[model samples]
Target: MTDENTTVPARPRGGLLRYVVAATLARTADGGAVVAIVLLVTASGDPGWLAGALGACITAPHLLGPFVARSLDTTRDGRRVIALASVVHGATLAAAVLLYPSTHAIVPAALLIASGLLGPLLTGGISSRLPAIAGPSRTSQRRAQGWDVATYGVGGTVGPTIVAAVSAWASPHTSALVLTLGTFIAAGFVMLLPYSPPASDARDVPRPARTLVVMFSSGPLRRTLYLTMIVAFSVAALPIAAVASTDQLGTDDAAAGVLTAAYGLGNLAGSIGVMARPLEGNADQLMTRLATLVATTLLAVALAPSFSLATAAYAAAGIANGYFFAATLAARNEYAPSEIRGQVFVWTGALKITAGSTGTALTGAIVGTAVHLPLVLAIALTTAAALTSASERRFVTRQVRAADHVQPGTVRRD
Candidate 1:
């Protein structure tokens, strides 16, 4: 099964750059939206509850991502859906802008939530298009994934700064509108990219619902899902810790942002590294090691006595994070039936969002208490690593079986 790279796309590096650029622009709005919402809520002086509501809005769409991704079968249909989503997303943002005058918070929040709820379909549409654009080669597909991850890394690194700058000059509502406009522009750019649907004869013909359910049934995928969730939770620790350390230890907001940026920079570098080489070994082994590295580094970050040490720890954590993201995606790609790839990916997105929200909640609850922040994070990460290792072992066994059944001699011929 691992050797079955037949259906994967093959495209030149140049083609990937076009998609990458589009991806960068596409994600910019999403990232910028995060900052805009955060600032808006912070400025409203209801940071805790409003921020939590915003987080719910953003993560809620992911819950249905797996379900919606089942529709990514037809290239034409997928493209139309993406374009329509872009328009709707823009309209919702405009609503937010107008409703800002109400000052009741509920109306603007409804608009924000609506905008977020529609994002999965748009994102799923894009992922489906990637395979088409990349062609039928494993290398090309990997590169495409690399490009997407790189764009994500870049956007994450700079998104907050952009929001801060905009808010400083304008208002949060204006910034939100600006970000929405950018989303529409990116959607147009992506629409211009060439794509050909899987040939009708070659396309997967399974019942869409059944195929989607199968994604969660796979042992490797389940393990991956669990690990991804933990990684999401772990994500909250760094930024929260950085801010607290600075607030309590006299580190400036600028310093905290620098540390965060360093982590993102590391993620950018790691994406390139994964793209440069194919993942050929045991998927479980790779993920376990990376998860352990991330946890260990986070522990170190928690224990650091100075800003510089914390910065380095965060950067190292980012590198581990980058590797984990790439490796997990590659593994998911390798194992998932091409027919259901979008469903799997969108579900992964949901898992990531929920895990992150959980992590943030935990961080907020424990940071000011009797528990030492480093110890708490270290324990969470270490537990995650152990859990990941166990799940990966089970996952590898199932993958080996799945691989065996796919080989010519293994399954009984009809």
Candidate 2:
């Protein structure tokens, strides 16, 4: 729901800046851990299926993000919780990287799941406290929210690029392990933040079912959720696509990361550009057009005549996706019911992670020595997303007006 004029507390701005840095690093560390796991397993002759499985394990916790964030909000020692969560996130990731080979699936999957559950603390958990950090007025809070949104966009795309690029030149296992240290660095910053969790009331935490009902009742919001999920699912597979594409082209395996890094680069560029110059009107319409573009580019990548052409097509799809991500963010805020404004961000962010996990798993199952199937499937999903863009006019506004209205928890922009 839109908080067109939401105000902020007169807290100092200093912590907000530090929180942003910590959140960015935490995101980077998570991405690095996932890629590191995938690379480690695939290099050791395990089927790529485990790679997707691990990705999903990390993402599943997002489904429970609101509850977890709420729980954190009630505690007086919220700063410690955030710090401990960060450490746990890194520790679990590092354990999986080091022990996945010997323990196989179950233990490592559990570790990743634990890490994923802590994800909200480093991201949405902190973002919710923004009113206190940004200070004095709603406009300042909104500006802060904008930065959080951009960080989410960049973190999602860049983490893979950095890790994959390093793997291209260094030991995948060692690089993965080294990258996990960033989480500890993030923990240090989080520990220092002045996180005074607001006095909590258990009665205020919206039931998960109620939150889900609210989302489903709004047609535009529902479609946006589906769009976010499908887009995420499709993008998650690109890493594996890199491996499959290289195999099909019989290129040096070391260069496979170039394809992955290219997509990340394009996505980062597109998201940043859009944020700098906000789009003019009709966010849903923009989403439809950009989603179509994304599907078309994915199709192009699938049928490209050579490895180089495929890489270019892949990057094009990423750019279109970046634009779509921005549009989706706009659509969510515009259409989400005012009653549930608080919960929208974190819940949807969870859905994105969950969708990504599904995408990664599906790709692992079907991916072989070619990129055709995964890219084609991505095209199909994005096409569905395009078709799903439009909804009955005023439907969301009507739903909000009629909603039984619960003031939910803080917004998690990611």
Candidate 3:
């Protein structure tokens, strides 16, 4: 008879690294898509309004991403989801290249939204498969997550540079074509990866009751998620602010693009920093401070009288945002149970996307009309962050207690 008191260790499956690499390549496709749309509209000299409209349209699918990602929870075949989503994303990019301008703005806008919808599905589906890939070691799982973030950062930095060079050397249309081809390449890579569903696949899973419960089980996690949402929204807001600042500075869009690039640079730096020295000892307290720092910097950007000051402030915001994101995610991986991790992560992405899209839309509406757009946004973020900070310490302590009960060896193995 099998030993009743002992849990058997599962096999350490191979090809996880392949999946990671493929996922990174797929992410590069997303970055190229962003660049293709931005350059195409800007090159046309159709004014900033069209650019912003396109962005909002592209991101609209995120509003439905949570609902879409739920399918992964009910299904055991995560690999199929990832594979099909990749193909769809590739096809959508191809369609965008062939049809965006010729088919009218609305048609392309809808296509972009459909492409955006694939992201959350891919994210949720892959995360659900991690347990199979990482086996039983919690540390191994965390390491995998860290590596994934690193890959994403590297791809994000490289994609725009390539797009800029290609657009300059050829044209926006050529860049779009390149993006379409890149997506197809990425899809091919993903198809070659192995499939590994979690051992929990045999067990019955519950439907998600609510978004809040999905993301906010641990107090610290909830607080961190809120901070992250704000930061992401601020990211969406940065381009708007950059454009305004460039106009104020009597410079070209290149200046604004520089500031935007600086923000992404800061994000990469922050992600690297977090991975190098993981959040330890009072993680929630540290994140609270970082959130406060981000809020204060946003406020500073709002009040800045000069273009250089605003640019610096935006960079600072990006750094704080990245640090908070990485550290908080590390903490969540430690806190959330493996079975529900995908659900939580799915909602987290949903919140980030929703907040980001809303931020862009709100800022787009307000920046030109409002006297001090940055100041207003700053105040909003500061107030939300301050409330979160005050609650963080208590939240962390409570979560620690909860984790003590739920951690491996404390509860019966599933």
Candidate 4:
């Protein structure tokens, strides 16, 4: 059944541009916090463990994503919820900046965790609103998703650059303050968004656990989630492999930096390409192809004889990474039920973050043992993702064909 509240009016001439700007700012705030925190911790002469602790604090709130999204789902006006979250997020960041000089760890930790709780407003919340802004056209939605992915790439690249540049000229505290101000600006942008409230339906809302169960029970969504996690793990391992490649080449750490930048450039290029011309094929199939490309490139990087070769391979992998991200978002929109779509997006984001964090820690532990181990492991994971996608496709196709063959009046029991 179509939900009237969810249906966007015919495309307004400049509606999409407004949403793009809002989403970009939101992503910038998200990425800026990460860069600002790292600089802040480093400049304070804190132990490495403090930095790690801060990272955990930032990511820990994501564990509550489903619950948060559930609450949002209960409300008709998601935009208001998102706007409020953004304000709270900005306020907490501002508080963290003001309290940075305190000797106690608890104050900063608590503030950071409070800010992190609003991360979904910037990420999945914005994404969930895309369909509304893009109207009912599939092409428009695809373009919007592509732009969304590109904004993420841009934010990740620009946020660190801004923090690093400011920190170089001034103090890390100054950079943190700047980022805190930026968060407020982002909140302003979010509040300006024109999304209508999702239409309330008569269907019963499932409990969070039941919603999760229904989501995972769907073949396509399950495969997509698995693919997202595997790809995230591989992407996280890239930095570990980049460091190892520098060691293998007996080169300066600058080589690793260059390699990392190469990947980012490729990711940006791929995202732009998708924005210009969206992928053509089944979402699952496109995802499978992209995962295969990532796996193959990682394998090549592992075997690369020179730093140059490794850099090229990593960049290639990153291009595939960008496309894969877009495909997965599209898949989520395609496969998830409307009632729980927000939860699904938030859940997916949390899982990807968790997988990436876990992969980074694992890679750190093992990369010292073998220069190529991280890349090899990444390749294995991507390969498994591809296989899983292929299996899902076959299973779904069988189910469709079987249903087609069944008599009209008779129900077939599985």
| Clash number for each model | 8, 2, 0, 0
Residues 1-414 of candidate 1: C-alpha lDDT, one tens digit per residue: 324545534444455566676666556666677677767777877657777677466556656555555555534346665666667776886687567646677787788777776666555446556766765556656666666677777766555667788889988877777777777776776667675564343245355457656866786676676777787688666676676677554577778777777788878877888788744566656667777777777777767777787778778888788888766776667676666666666677666766776787788788787335734764576566657567667767798998877886565776
RMSD of each: 4.9, 7.9, 6.6, 3.4
Name the candidate, 2 or 4, with the larger TM-score value.
4
Query: Per-residue lDDT for 198-228 in model 2, tens only?
Result: 4445465556567778888876677777888
Cα lDDT, model 2, residue 138:
34
Task: Give the Å error, residue 348, model 2.
Answer: 2.0
Which candidate number has the best TM-score? 4
Query: Where does candidate 2 clash, by residue pair?
Result: 1-336, 1-337
Candidate 3 steric clashes: 0
Candidate ordering by lDDT (highest first): 4, 2, 1, 3
Q: Point out where model 3 deviates above 4 Å.
A: 1-20, 38-57, 100-110, 122-146, 154-157, 188-195, 199-203, 208-212, 216-221, 246-254, 282-286, 299-313, 369-372, 379-383, 392-414
TM-score of 1: 0.82
TM-score of each: 0.82, 0.71, 0.76, 0.92
1-414: candidate 3 lDDT, tens digit per residue: 123344765554555676667666666766667777878888878678887777665556655666666556555665666777877876776687678577778887777888888866555445545545644444454445555566556666666777788899998878767766665666665656555554355355545556457456667667767776777676677778788777666678788887777777777766666656544545566667776777777777676677777677777877777776655565555555555656666667667768877788788888888646754775678567757667766666688998876887665566
Error of 4 at 68 (Å): 1.0
Positional deviation of 398 in candidate 4, in angstroms? 2.4
- Model 1: how far is 53 from its true place, Å? 3.3
User: Per-model C-alpha lDDT, please?
Assistant: 0.68, 0.71, 0.66, 0.79
Residue 272 displacement in candidate 4 (angstroms): 0.6
User: lDDT winner among the candidates?
Assistant: 4
**Candidate 2 at 360: error in angstroms?**
2.7
- TM-score for predicted model 4 compared with the true structure: 0.92
lDDT at position 291, candidate 2: 74
